[model samples]
Target: MQWPDLFDDDNVDDDDLSEMTRKYLPDTVVWTTDWTTGSLIEQLERNVFNVDPPFQRRSAWSDTKASLYIESLLLGCPVPPVTLAELPAQGSEGNFQYVVIDGKQRLTTLKRFALDGELKLTGLKVLRDLNGRSYSEVEQEPEFRRFANLPVRTVVLRNWKKDEVLQFVFHRLNTQTTPLSTHELRRALLAGGFTDYLDRESASSEGLQRILGISEPDYRLRDAELLLRAIAFVRYSNRYKGNLKQFLDTITRSANRSWSEPFARELDEVVGSINSAISAVYDIFDKGAFQRIDDEGQPSGRFNRAVFDILVMTFQNETIRRAATADPQAVRSAFTVVNRNPDFKRFISGTTKTPEAVNGRLRIWWKQLSSALELPYESFEQVQTW
Candidate 1:
């Protein structure tokens, strides 16, 4: 939240520093590009410099989307421009940080296409000519295949000042055209190191969802941001605060390496942890509060907010301490004690617990569970809950 020095020579002039800011473009502007200039990589690397802006989540486009963008660029397709916003300098990392104000999905798609080259596109190509005619007129068109090898058109706003960037981020991210959630922004920005490692290990949402048993994939579940937030909160055990991406990168890098694993193995463990915690949340925390049952056999008025906090605390402790060990029995027994604990209802709701009280409970829970589960975490003590 650092503001640039308006009095600095670079930002203000003696004659016009006092001039009132005015806009002719409603305080926001957007542009387009083809991905041919290799700008996708440039922008992504520029994003690396924008460490604070890591509030945007990690890369989430599927391999197919990447391939499609590549195909579009190669075929001279008219793709939409990438969006940018100029925001004030927050720090050295943000001297010229530009938020991708909009078009993150498209940009991500293009980057993955260039880096991985493993995307699968639907049967469509970008070779439709004027008069709305496709290349259908040419039989066995060799040109279409040739076009598929090219890059995309890229549109970008060059160096913009910070206020304009903030205004742009606010507008595009808040709009209905394809809103980016706080959680998704967390994914884009906060994702690196352990989170990125976790993402790399289990990139597919279907795989993670299948393991968690949360629900079948649908519109709500399809949101990459929701999945990222769930993963990050469970993996790191932190609240979904602003600028989470940057925070995670810094913390996770300093965190114990023992907690991370290859994408497949860690993914399995994360899925298990989230599923168990989520179930515990509903069964012991949410459903515990209600006597009313709907005709569908679901609780009508159950409040499960308490369990969510408990789970967050429990998860967060593990992240800080690297509680997951190499031993399998230890992990199982640790969580089993969590399953048997009975005070989550009072704990998370503040009915009988303050933040201090909650940490005490978690300490006891982890100690007994780790011992019961034979986990390596028995040696790691718990920290304060949020």
Candidate 2:
């Protein structure tokens, strides 16, 4: 369950990109616009632009970098254009017209300087004379007044057929610069009720956070990703092939769009079941619930994603949850045996994203667990489609 020792290299399979390309591509219109800095700052002040969209990375530039950017603007240096996806206004409630898809750092810097009056230009090689001056200090000056009139280029994506297309575009846009993680792209591309629900649930789930060793919301969205992984496996493991990332991505986008009362209720049940399973694990393994078992029969090492996947998914069954809850020690003992099984360890440690490895280990663990709990043992073929 420990991350396969670094020395234990295995050939992980690639996702089915051909399938993804066919599914994700959709017809969309792209257009360009020029916004003066003064107008853009006004939009920032009025909240017409969503600068801090959930998919964007946090402002990463140091004060020095931000200062350099401001200098570039003042010196009339050409900067990369910002990209935005125009949100539908029907349900927007006058909140925002566009979400920043790229150039968040640059837009944020502009807001800090022009709107917030917080940035003081420094480390300016070209504008050294203005190094220590804030925007307010130079606003009345003729040279600095021209800063507001600077035209910034922006590209907008509109008339998209699906949210997934935006997600795909965002992924492509950031891949060369600051690459977005898979979860980050998902969050950006699928910003509907289901993703929103995941945000709320993952933030509030004490048990899930504790098991995953997170105290606050994970900026990387790892906590949400884990929850999604569990849900995806529980709901669609039978349909999974070797492409773990695409599988999760496809499901997340679909769920986000299709989120409804029934879907929410079903997800709530799954979350509750997961919580029940976590409670049972805590009773037995304590903090070691999702970690590797040591030779001394104690939980050891970091949390294992593979272990978490199979164990939580299995224990989520109501019958299994009850069985483990009734006899925590038996489950614990069964875990020790399963943990030490050479084949099970192999499946978890190396190139474990494939179907053979994923389902193989689940089968092994379930066989041991069912015997330990004295429940009817079901084959993975029968169980996975659930």
**lDDT scores of the candidates, listed in order:** 0.42, 0.74
Root-mean-square deviation of every model: 13.4, 6.1
- Spell out the clash pairs found in candidate 2: none
lDDT of 1 by residue, 1-386 (tens): 11121101111121221221233233344455455435455656556323223332444455445556545655556666555544456786656555554566666554444333333344344533311223232224564444544455434454443232333343444554433333333333334554454444334444334322334332212234334444554555443333333333344444324445565476566555554444433333333321222344343343232233344445444442243333434544444444345554234333322344445455655676556545555344433322
Judging by lDDT against the true structure, name the best candidate: 2
Cα lDDT tens digits, model 2, 1-386, are 12233112212222334444456464577889999878888888887777656533334577899999888778777888988888777454655377677776788898889887888988999768888899988676566766778889999988766555665666678655544445655675567888887777877777777864657665556567778888888888887887876788778878987889999998898888777777777777776777767667777756777888888887777767777888988988898998788888888876678899988899888899888888778633354445
Off by over 4 Å in 2: 1-180, 294-300, 379-386
Worst 10 residues of 2 by lDDT: 6-15
Q: Which has the greatest TM-score?
A: 2
